[model samples]
Target: MDFSALNKSAANSFNQQKSLIKKVLAGKKVKCNNCNTLISVHTGADSVMIKCEKDCTDIKLDAELLK
Candidate 1:
């Protein structure tokens, strides 16, 4: 019956993730753990992806993080 708590929790989660994304973007040391190469960030219509150029790692996140 109480949605306020749920909404606040969700908002907090989103904010945390967004902050992480910003850090990743601003960091120059971001690299693929598997291959030790630089990772690439790509944004699409509904999603964002962080991938290694050598195909060693791939991460997909919600596009809302970029907003």
Candidate 2:
């Protein structure tokens, strides 16, 4: 995965939402609503809604990292 782009996007999206990011990062686990996959919420931003590159169905947003 091109984390550079993800990180960039997350940073931009969470520019003013530092608290959100912190909350997400504080947790060790996160889940993908579309794929039901568990992802780790580490750095960058919280619940950064990203499009699924594998199968672009409906817009999949990260639910773990939200306000």
Candidate 3:
């Protein structure tokens, strides 16, 4: 997604979310949607997919971070 249109506040929020995710995950495997558990991280990827632990829905990170 093109995030260039996001305002300064929104961009800041997005960055903050990314930072939080990095801190939380901390180089460990995470769960995915559709019951596929323990998905590993892809190195240097701009986007990361995180499954909702409570609802089992695939949430697209970085793009939705600014929304």
lDDT of each: 0.71, 0.47, 0.53
lDDT of 2 by residue, 1-67 (tens): 9999999987786653454335445664434445755544322354443322333222333656354
RMSD of 3: 9.1
Which runs of model 3 end up more than 4 angstroms from their true locations? 1-6, 27-47, 51-67
Q: Clashing residue pairs in candidate 3, if any?
A: none
lDDT of 2 at 43: 29
lDDT of 1 at 7: 91
Model 3 lowest lDDT segment of ten: 36-45
Candidate No. with top TM-score: 1
lDDT of 1 by residue, 1-67 (tens): 6899999887877765455456667765576656888877887889988777886556688878667
What RMSD, rounded to one decimal, does every model reach?
A: 7.2, 10.9, 9.1
**Of 1 and 2, the candidate ranking higher by lDDT:** 1
Instruction: Summing lDDT over every window of 10 consecutive residues in candidate 2, give the lowest-scoring window.
Output: 50-59
Better of 1 and 3 by TM-score: 1
lDDT of 3 by residue, 1-67 (tens): 5557567657766775465456445865545435655544332356656544544544366644434
- Model 2 misplaced stretches (Cα beyond 4 Å): 1-23, 41-67
